[model samples]
Target: MPEFTYDMLVIGSGPAGQRAAIQAAKLGKRVAMAERRGVVGGACINTGTIPSKTLREAVLHLSGYRLRSLYGASYTVKQHITMEDLLFRTDHVVRHEIDVTLHQLMRNDVDLFNAHAQFVDPHTLRLIDLDKRGTRAMRHLSAATIVIAAGTEATRDEHIPFDGQRICSSDDVLQMQRLPHSLAVVGAGVIGLEYASLFAALGVRVTLIDKRQRLLSFIDAEIVDTLAHHLRENRVTLRLGEEVSGMEPFNDVSGDRVRIQLASGKQVVTDAALYSIGRTGATNDRGRISVNERYQTNVPHIYAVGDVIGFPSLASTSMEQGRLAACHAFGVEATSVPALFPYGVYSIPEISMVGRTEEELTAEGVPYEVGKAHYREIARGQIIGDTIGLLKLIFHLQTHALLGVHIIGDGASELIHIGQAVLSLNAPIEYFVNTVFNYPTLAECYKTAAFDGINRLGGVRQDAVATSSRN
Candidate 1:
């Protein structure tokens, strides 16, 4: 037997990496983790998820986007909310999160190396210390089992170079000194739309460009349509089906604007350009894991998970992927996940869904019925000044079982969990219809939608009426 030093070595200190390391350590295995940053918590807690979410919250509050209707457009004294306000909360939250994460790791006895790590072989990793005083300062390490959760990097396309002034990536948004009066966001994916929405809310004239015909093409079309309408209402322009041909930094244009020429023969002059389509596996450097089923690489001892592996690159799913990988690595069979999982887009008016989309159902030839409840019709939505939102429910025609739930509006992400639970349990539409939710709540929409779906199942409608009459 080859002498293995540590029982497990977790690469990356993000949510997935951290969870896997802690889980393995709890199983009485000596574990260690490699973190590129000087601090412990990975990009999720540090830059990407937490920072962006905090920025969105700050933008929502200061811009008075939430209270504009109630206060009659005079709510915001300062139309511009500074980056400091956004970064202040982000810095506080991330520091606390990192401190808590370090405490947890210390309690679990997981060694943390603040250096860049690469594969020496299948089982060995060479960690090079970033601080350079002399030539031979770094060290090498080996482990029995390795988990690759290095996450992903921003996709910097060849056409546009990020100079951090005229052009930048999502990471640069937080560190920006002055806010732009107008911005061009290339790529209408989650990251692109997120920043675009927040900036538009802050009164920056934004032009969003996407190569595809629609934004978030994989989501429920109705939900995407609603979100797009909201974005448009904020004065954000959509330039779909257009690609960037070239970009020139207009150094002569005062106040740092970028002149971009599009493939559609459109010239866009914006205060700055943000390229958000950059996404590639962080494991490209290590080359240890095969991007295969169960997230195992060529070396059986090494594994990969989260955004690095590709589709459904959500922080929520990424954490689960990490846990499942850990379970399989330790030879413990865990509960199998159902086909249905929730989707969340954290825009100003968020979007979330669970189970099959209407298009997917149609393509599969599955007979289904849909029931919709607009947020405007719901009391809670009116109370919160949210008039532009919708809840959609799909059900199997024969079985009256819940096939999917799609939501777009405030608290859509949180509200989708109830639908997720129902789908996971294989509950029928009647389950929600029979269950009475609290009055004047967003959740009541689910009940209303369920009733509508159940009624569409043909016999359920008569049966419900008969039962009601008997009662």
Candidate 2:
């Protein structure tokens, strides 16, 4: 066998790539990571996740949306919030994330290369230098194993005339020179909903359009219905079962206003429109590389993870995928990631869920019972003024084993983990009922829900009744 430059060569420096490189380095293997952007973190830190979430926090703080009920709906945190106000904190957060990522790579002794990388062969890569101006210097390196975590980019269609001023993608939302008086978001997916809710909180009239009749159908139907209700209350118009046929600038308007025509003969004029329909894998030409359960591509010794492989494309899951792939490459035995990890959508009223949905269980003919606790019924919920939040638990009627958990409200993302831990341990519903939680806390909902479910199972089989007591 020919001598290789490094044991592992990782492409892209996103969450997955960084984790893979660091994991291999920790194992005392020579590792190198190549990034085209000349930065340690990929689009996740530069454009997509970090920037968007930071902007969301700014909007919440400056808009005074959270205190509207207590302040009688006539209070504003700032008289006039501008684009600069929203981006001020975002810039700091991005810089901090990049610095931290770079420090991690340096401390682990992973070589960093700033260049565009392309495969010369299965075992070799060609790197085009990105730092030197106008000089086309190229370098080739071979490795024993390769991992691709190139991430994804926002999709754009030629039919849509995107001037970046009137018609923009989600990536351009953060770069706007000023806030729009009104906005139209052209997708009902996670990205679309998050941005729509954010801008709406800033007192912008937002119209969300989608061809699908429902939003986030994969989530719990009851939770989605609640989100839809809150969105409408926030003055966001939902144009479901509709599609944008075309769009053009409104000549009658002096400003940058666009007229969006729909297939349903409806017209909407807004200062700007965000087309967040979908995202494409960043892998050149071949699209997404297919991978097996081990995250290895069709070509042995080469692996792909994260958004490039699709489905549940989240930073948290991507990190785990990278670690698992690295362990497998070095012949280290490790447990696979759990099939039921949490899914979080960071909208105004966040939504999160773990395990199977009620729809899935019903379709599979699994005998299950649902227990629910509304925030309005809890003291902590009233103190925080989150009357709309809810916690729902699903359990097997026969076995009393916890099956699933769903939550929608503030801190939903963080709250879902408690239920996740219980489900992971294969614990029964009695665990919550038998335990005590701190006072004036949202976690007490678990105990409330457990008792609710137990009360519903009044006429269970005698054997099952005895099992509950023993548990």
Candidate 3:
């Protein structure tokens, strides 16, 4: 019985929780993870990242968003797309993600428990099984170390009435039974913008409302401007620097509609509203726990990671945080997270960046030169009908060392990795200039941008070498 007790226990099966348990099991520790949902992959796989991205892909394909420019503005790949059409792909992807996560845990010999976990003490946890009807089964378990990767929940305010129909949260969007003709997105965060762009691509009139003057202020300003331009071109309305005062349901011939009143004495009526203002840590009543650099809570043996830790709550970063926490718990030395990691926003046309932004470098008084490569200049861009995409590279004016890479357009998320690799190695601009790349590919943009940067610095132009390459 003593041996059966877990050496490490992780609550929540998100990217963070899954990685934490796997890391602990890899260290030959008895590891177990408890998830409230019957599924293993937590919110990321079930509702947040995986499902939303899948839905976006489906919307893009069925709506003929990419082919619109070449085929004409009125052309649509599919005319009568329904909610089921979008959810079919999303459901399939989510199930596959959950299965993959389960397989990973099983192969690593990590025990899985389906229950809501609550701390009875520092080391002991009470697991309540709500799956059983009429009777709630409870089990108590003791672990040498505990990880609270419970993630976060979509915040709900009492002032707003969310019916999961007329007005819904981001999570509720996944469970929507039908698509609305028009939608008013009440937030302009990543999730809000992604959904707004997706729906707009599907021919829905989307109005994005936010109190802030800009969207995703953490991103490079130029990239944000490009995204804003694309959103406007797609016919998505922006209502920035305006606060929503209240909402009321109105009955119309088209069915139920939401009248959103703004603090600036304005009103907008839409078929539905998506309220995606923020999220709160799902750590039950205990809330977010404080952690040290090693991800250890004040109660030494306890740790927290992922969205529960707050800020930059990306699935990729969450996975790393979980692995690092496990390493620290087992006294294993782990490499610190890199100073620069890529951030991929899955909005229509996409946006990705790594390293420091131009704004940050300028504010820090770091001398840098900017190099840009528009997709129109790349052969593959025309082939794929993404001529509006742009890649910007920032490098040290003196050292020619790669400083930042920002991209906004189709496949921007995929293309940013090349820049990330160069940045991680602290490689100089000449690396890209001298390196041979496959012709007629988006990857060639790096070479072009590098040459453009070198030329701006008055270095010898390598344009002849790049131009002479075979496609």
* Candidate lDDT values, in order: 0.81, 0.88, 0.88
Q: Per-prediction TM-score, please? A: 0.94, 0.95, 0.96
lDDT of 1 at 178: 74
For candidate 1, what is the lDDT?
0.81
Top TM-score model = 3
**Which of the predicted structures, 1 or 2, would earn the higher lDDT when compared with the native?**
2
TM value for model 2:
0.95
* lDDT of candidate 2 over 337-394, digit per residue (tens): 6798999999998899999899999999999998888877777887777788999999
Candidate 1 lDDT tens digits, 1-471:
788778888889888888889888888888989898778867788778988888888788778888766776457745557777667778888888889999999999999988788889998888877765644347777888899899877767666767876698876667777788889999899889889988888888999998889888788998888888888988999999998888877666375679989998999998888888856677655422346666677788898877777777778777877877788788888764445778887887888888989999999999989878787778888899888878999988877778899999889999999998988888887786677788889998887777666555544644353232111
Q: Residue 87 in model 1: shift from native, Å?
A: 1.7
Per-residue CA lDDT of candidate 3, range 1-471, in tens? Answer: 344378999999999999999999999999989999878887899879999999989988888888877897677888888999999998888888888999999999998999999889888899998865746889999898999999988877678989988899987887777899999999999999999999998888999999999999889999999889988988899999999999978998878899999999999999999999988889765666778888898899999999899867899989999999999999999986666889999998899999989889989999999888888888988888887899999999888889999999888899999999999899987788788888788988888887788777665534334432422
Residue 105 accuracy (lDDT) in model 3? 95
lDDT (C-alpha) at residue 80 in model 3 = 81
